[model samples]
Target: MTVDLERAAPAAPPAPPRRESRIWLVATAVTAVTVLLIVYPLGRTVLGVFGIGADSTVGRIGEVLTSGETWRLALNTVIAVSVGSVVALMIGAVFAWINERTDARMGFAARMLPLMPMFVPSIASAIGWVFLASPKAGVLNGWLRDVGGWFGLEMVEGPLNIYSWPGLIFAYVLFLTPYAYLTISSGLQSLDPALEEASRDAGAGALATFRRITLPSLRPALGASVLVTVTMGVAIFSIPLVIGTPADIDVLPVRIVHMMTHSYPGDIGGALGLSLLVVAAVGGCWLVQRRMLAANAHATITGRSSAEAAVTLGRWKWVARSAMLLFLLLTSVLPLAGLVLVSLQGFWSAEVRWGHLTFDNYRYLVDNELVWAGLRNSLVLAVVCASVAMAVGVLVTLVLARRRGRVASTVDAIVKVPSTLTHIVVALSFIVAFAGPPFDLAGTYLLLAMAYVVLYVPQATFYATAAYHQVGPQLSEASAVSGAGDGTTVRRILLPLMAPGLIAGWSLVFVLMTGDITASSMLAGTHTPVVGFVILDMWTAAGYPKLAALGVLMTLVSSAVVLLVMTLRDKLLVVR
Candidate 1:
């Protein structure tokens, strides 16, 4: 009996080390790949700023670190990113709490179907608001001024200004809220109800319970939201370019682009040097987030968490619903309304002459070869990029599922870092690393595809990891016991089970790459033009009517995709 028991102990020990060894192998492999593909490029750019090894005539002898203007722009950039993230975070957290903790009859995506607005290229949102609130001839401002006479408060262009600091922040909040809402709402839905219920049973009121128990538990989500806002704030170009530029507000992103595009030799040193500040800022934020995560892990999600004990809002539910609808109105209805009206007009004007409206913009879109070529290219690239990224995600996740330890934990954190990096930084890195000489991939779709895959693979990894965890290790083990090989197990068991999540992730990636502006603006040229570049060109040419038409079309396509995903969710994601 003693010998048999000792034999069994040795057997169990052997199994664990083998599993652990596999995990370490995976973690090491993933780390090496990311360092080469993602980190190496970014690091190369940083080095080039100081006249290190670079093929381009970027940092000549005395030119390195000479741009004092970059330092000046950094101040305004810091202020805008900081303030915008805070305000956007507040709005997002408030809405999340109302939807999850209170008795509000609304969900950001579930019931409202507001993703249509969220999916619209942020460029459209910025431009739409410009039309709605610009001082001279804004649609809403004009209406407001017309109504102001009744109150004897009539003044031209005194009501609103979309070209000011406040306007920039507002646009940022609108653009960022969806990301925060998605992150925080998922966190809230996954919290343990027992803790909140215990607080209530101990005679705590709803507000007190929330302040003490709920808020503490939501630290991870809140931290993630803050990071998302900060990253978006740093990378965001559309609103600042359209709204802030008019007001002479030179943020870092705009400055970086101007250094590259507005100069003759293209000030690569100054541009990349400016990009380093963004890197430092992100690195600092990430450090803080990691510390917060480590210190506040008591509220972490497990597989067994139950539904929350929702607080009753009673009559206030209507008020909550109205507030949500009001957000939708501002984000989707107002912007789209403005786009439609402007597109139909001959030019942007406060007075809408129905007889003067024309469809010339739409006709041009249909007739132009570049527009069709851009659309086709974007479509093909989206599918290809998403597939490649997700394929890598699945491979990493499969290895991760084989074991669980410190190495696996490290691997998880490392995978998510790419998603946190600014898209502009990613684009600039790709340029500095692969755009010249040995690569000479400057104008090729292959370079663009690689950038998209590297930039977005983290998101794909996240979705794949979630799906894998949901299936758990039991099924995979069972398949192994039944004599199925790895490929067979993945095909017959894991893929089918993970389909719902994979589909959702693929859909997100598809839309994101198609409407991408930051990378497209920097990396793509006329030879390989994308939809984003086309839109930006129209903006440059002051073709407001044509821009509006294209913007409206993009919105419709986005909305249609969102609707299709929703409809398919019912049939495909069912757990029967």
Candidate 2:
């Protein structure tokens, strides 16, 4: 009398062997492309370094490893990164704790603090600092000199030099702080408040409870933040190029750049050597963090609301608020004011002649052939690369989400390969890989675009994965039942639902590419001038006003593009 529903239901046919084979072949092809894109550049460089034609190059590796200059490079790099990471972590963690837990929150403004670097290019920020803190012409120095005059402490030069070690480290910290804040703040939001309440019930003070419970719980965040800060500091070229180069405080990235660009015959050998060292260091940190994460360095309770009563700071609340304001001023207000004033000054000078300020620099931006070309190239490159990368990311994410087994595993591993490398290292590898021989793509938009896609694919994939997971699978299943194939379902249902996220990912890459200097520094040339290259050219020509104006223009253009993408996404979603 059993219903036997399983037997009564019609059996679904298994996937055909030819279709399955085609799927495998497609996955293999995708894997091959991913490997070629991510690995070929770096592998080509290393192979060239050790090949027969590279006898001198291989020998130079030993020379570089054994020399006093190399030691100074390593030592200086370590000191800068170590100090910068700690200071950045402290400032960022303090900001996160205050904003997330204390009564000093500033609502939406506080949330935007971590996104400081996205639009405000680090190169622009560093140049602004140079104009603000240069020994002779720094505006801040001028103000200090005027202040010191009242106290009769007269001096012609600075008590502050942005060309010094402090200056270099300060520049690094400014960029790194936001990274630390983001990770730590996310950790703070995820922690369970019940544990802290228990600690309070046990008669522990706020500080004591935090030390015992919160700090230990946040080790994962702290460790990840430090890793990011140190790696980024090591790979940073702008601070070192703008500040360290003049100060004679050489770091690895600047050293790499010098070997490639400063000499008539570029020291390709030496640059490759340093790049490998950076790769090793970054790879080691990534591996260590991965293991730590796997081993459960810390754990947090999830699926509960993170809203908790703000801890009263008593009279200290005002101090916390003041700290937030100071952060805002340092990271945003002062740097922006410096750029604005310098652009108006027409030349680099301490005294801002309000009446003499002109719009000639702005005019130059509009009129100059090379500058205008560079701006246009950067914009086009950003848009095109973002579109292509998002397309690839979505395709890869779909494969991983919908399929299973060895192919998926291979694809996942291949996609994450770029995450272990620093951008400048990857940029250098691209130069070595394609600047000669069969592939001679150097100085072309295709070359820069390929390098950008490689450098940012990991990020794109991560964002795409998040987007895929956000939508339910039931929608796709329903569409299949209603006779939609994979392509039709993706085109009609998935794309619309995924538009906002995909566009957001696009905006991130667009912003980065439009203002990018690391890759552009190595790969961009006269034929394929980009905003970053022009900015560097301005630096060399002593055209401070034009430099500032161009930087401001680049930032504004990037912001506009991001806003436009978002607007289009909204309209498209509404239309669909």
Highest-lDDT candidate:
2
What is the C-alpha lDDT profile of model 2 across 458-483, one tens digit per residue? 77887788777777788989998999
Error of 2 at 239 (Å): 1.1
Cα lDDT for residue 38, model 1?
74
Work out how many backbone clashes candidate 2 has.
0
Backbone N/Cα/C clashes per model: 0, 0
The residue-by-residue lDDT of candidate 1 on 1-576, one tens digit each, is 345544434444444443334434654576558547876787787576655674343544135346566666777788778887887677777777777677674544533433444577788878888888889878888888888979998686748998888988888778887887778877888787667878899999878988999888888888887777788788888778989899898888887776666766566666666777887888878777787788786834443333246677799888877777888889988988888888888888766778888898888878888777776787788878988888778777776666589977777676676678788778878887888767888878988998998888888888998988888879989998999776677889988888788777777877788788888877777899888778777788747878888888877876676568756765776663
Q: Each candidate: what lDDT?
A: 0.77, 0.79
**Candidate 2: residue 450 Cα off by (Å):** 0.2
Deviating ranges (above 4 Å) for candidate 1: 1-35, 49-51, 55-68, 107-117, 299-308, 403-414
What value of lDDT does candidate 1 attain over all alpha carbons? 0.77
Model 1, 567: alpha-carbon shift in Å? 3.2
